[model samples]
Target: MNRNDRAIVALVTLGHAMVHTYELSIPIFVSVWLASPAFSADAATLGVVATVGYGLFGLGALPGGVLADTVGSKRLIVGCLLGMAGSFALLSVASSVWVVAVALCLWGIAASVYHPSGLSLISRGVEARGSAFAYHGMAGNVGIALGPLAATLLLLVLDWRGVALVLTLPAVLGAVLALRFDVDERAAVADGGTETDGGEEAGDSKADAVSSWPEFVAGSKRLFAGGFVVIFAIVVCSGLYYRGVLTFLPEILGDFPSLQPVEFGGRSLEPGRYVYAGMLMVGVVGQYVGGRLTDRVQPSRVLPFAFGLLGLLALAFVPLSSVGLLPVLALCGVLGVALFVVQPLYQAAVAEHTPAGTRGLSYGYTYLGVFGVGALGGTLAGGLLTYADVGVLFVVLAGIGLAGALASFVLGRRA
Candidate 1:
């Protein structure tokens, strides 16, 4: 990797990390707020608020993709950071439910831009695509692990408001760093310099021209015609499974007698947060392994195994939890690994299947399915838990995973 590649990787990696940090940090705040008398909200009402935020995260991806192409990926990324920081700042000062909703909405909109912009930058700008994707995914896993850990630790020291304010620092720092780094692939393509390694030219000179809604639609149409629609469907199913199982994972883990108090650093910590964060930490290995595999094996081949196993594990999670602590912990670790392993596989698959011309828009729709439409999983989980047992919830999640597995299998054949 050259200096430019290092800068791009650093920028995108930081961007991906911060996005997950802010996202996962919200649940911590929700837990805190639910317990506080200030909110006076029931579980169901708070769940709805969280759902709104999650839904908006998904909803904002389309326009975010368009902006990535229009305004430039770097600019959009910087905007995402600044926007997330501002959202956190707002959240820090939030006094009512409505204010929290507004802040979360802002966060959703801000965070929506990152996938399209950062992934587009990597797919187009970086020389080592697979390695970059691996490192990027690994960075995301790091954030996934650290976000809850940091939030939980911060909660012990200060109020949730203070935590939100402190969390804003990272996005601000990331934004400043992003501004200093100049590795915009779109700009490079416009300069007629080949930025990608032996890859296709970024796009035609006409692609450098400004894109409007009509052109954006036409590009999406082309992507669909090129068989990316199948990938989109696969990602949607993956999203549903991912969001459903994880939405209440910490609470689910809290049900385990063995996980009642996870000890660390001579302190008995909250089992739910540590267990959840530990499982997410295991995903770092999965991210790195899955990422490296994409450079060697066919990404399609990697997809079915990971997705299918995730389905089986989702079904096994409840039964395993009833058995003993070690088995349940093992299952959670495997679940985390399987969950993240498919990410890089499909991310690489998306890059492989789409043309450079409309890659950002393709990623936009991809994330729309992954995050936007996927946000429904939280609501789905809430409804199921309200009416049914945990077994039923896992069964539904298993079904979603199996559906995704089937989609990936079909995608493999089609691709």
Candidate 2:
């Protein structure tokens, strides 16, 4: 791709990243705010609400994919951003449980539009899918990291409503920037002719041919055959492990009295929020490292290494919690970094396996695993923490990571 095209794709990716950060921030802030006396909802009720939003996010991917294929990814992306901004604005005014629930549902619907459209744009628009996706994932990691940290800081003076209002500005700005970029989805595919070569030229050519829904379904079925199933399983397991850790880490830290405060520059501060933010910031580094590794090492080789690190980190979470604040913070950062390394690997693997025409749907199906099946992590983590000890939660997550590691090994051998 030329420099201009590359720049446009980068801008689009950044816009999507900003919106994603805003969408994810709601849940994080809600979890914190619900615990406060200002909110009447109980933890269990808020958990239910969060589960519903996540479920909607997962379920929305299919329609979002179809819409991107039909209308245009650019349109869907901009529309979603607008919808997200409006939803957050509405959420800012919510005073009752029902109002917040309705607002959250809208947020979920808007959030759903992002992945299928944004990722599809990268695969279709950029020359280097791996590097582009790595950058894309890095943007997302930045959003994920910044959202909660910003929300936490806002909470020091402003109410949740004020925080939501503040967050809406970025989404509105993102929407405006998205509108400025003339990303023609149809033209993106039509620019390159159809030919199958396992190189950059082929990647560019495949980007030009848009597939119909029927073709997309047929191609996706083929993907599920052969070794794709193994990759899919690994992705699902990784997603579950990721969401499980991220959803519970704050609450887990909040429950522990000793590790709650950290001495920094001769002043003590509640470290839970900072630790959570630090973990996400580290994930951005992981995406860049993982993306480069994907270009050199086979995903089969790279995935096991990443997952092993994650598994080790998961096991360490329990022990580190008792070892004082610094160890816990370090572990959180390491786990956060390692947690997202699998994304580029999995996305690259899917791109390798599927036809170019159906890349969006292929990604959409993968998101079904990531968002749909992975959405279960919140409820599962919540239940595990509610019924069993937090150690049990860590143990279960560690086991899942180990399982993903084994699947990666098997997949590598098969590949």
Among the numbered candidates, top TM-score falls to 1
Models 1 onward score TM values of 0.93, 0.89
Q: Which residue pairs in model 2 clash with each other?
A: 189-208
The whole-model lDDT of each prediction reads: 0.82, 0.73
Q: State each model's C-alpha RMSD to the native.
A: 2.6, 3.3
Backbone clashes for every candidate come to 1, 1
**Candidate 1: lDDT over CA atoms?**
0.82
Error of 2 at 128 (Å): 2.4
Worst 10 residues of 2 by lDDT: 194-203
**Model 1 vs. true fold: TM:** 0.93
Tens-digit lDDT track of model 2 for 1-415: 5664576566756765786587557656756665777677655566666667776776787677656655667788778888888888998998777778788788878878778777767766666667777788888888988888888778667878899999889888888877777653533344464322233333443443345667556656666876778887987898688767776576677666654666666654556766777788888988888777777877887888788888888888888788776787777777877887888888777766655565666667777777767777777777776677789988988898898999999988988
User: What is the C-alpha RMSD, rounded to one decimal, of candidate 2?
Assistant: 3.3
lDDT of 1 by residue, 1-415 (tens): 7677788899999999999988877766766776689998755566667778877887788788777766778888899999999999999999999999899989998999999888888877777788999999999999988998899898777888999999999999989988988774743243463434554454563364238867876787777896588888888888888777777777667767777756677665677777888888899999999999999987888788888898899888888887887898889889889999989988888877776656678788889999988888877886787677789989988888888888888888986
- Evaluated against the true structure, the overall lDDT of model 2 is 0.73
After superposing candidate 2 on the true structure, give the runs of residues whose Cα lies further than 4 Å from its correct spot.
Answer: 38-42, 184-197, 200-217, 261-269
Badly placed stretches (over 4 Å) of model 1 are 184-210, 261-268
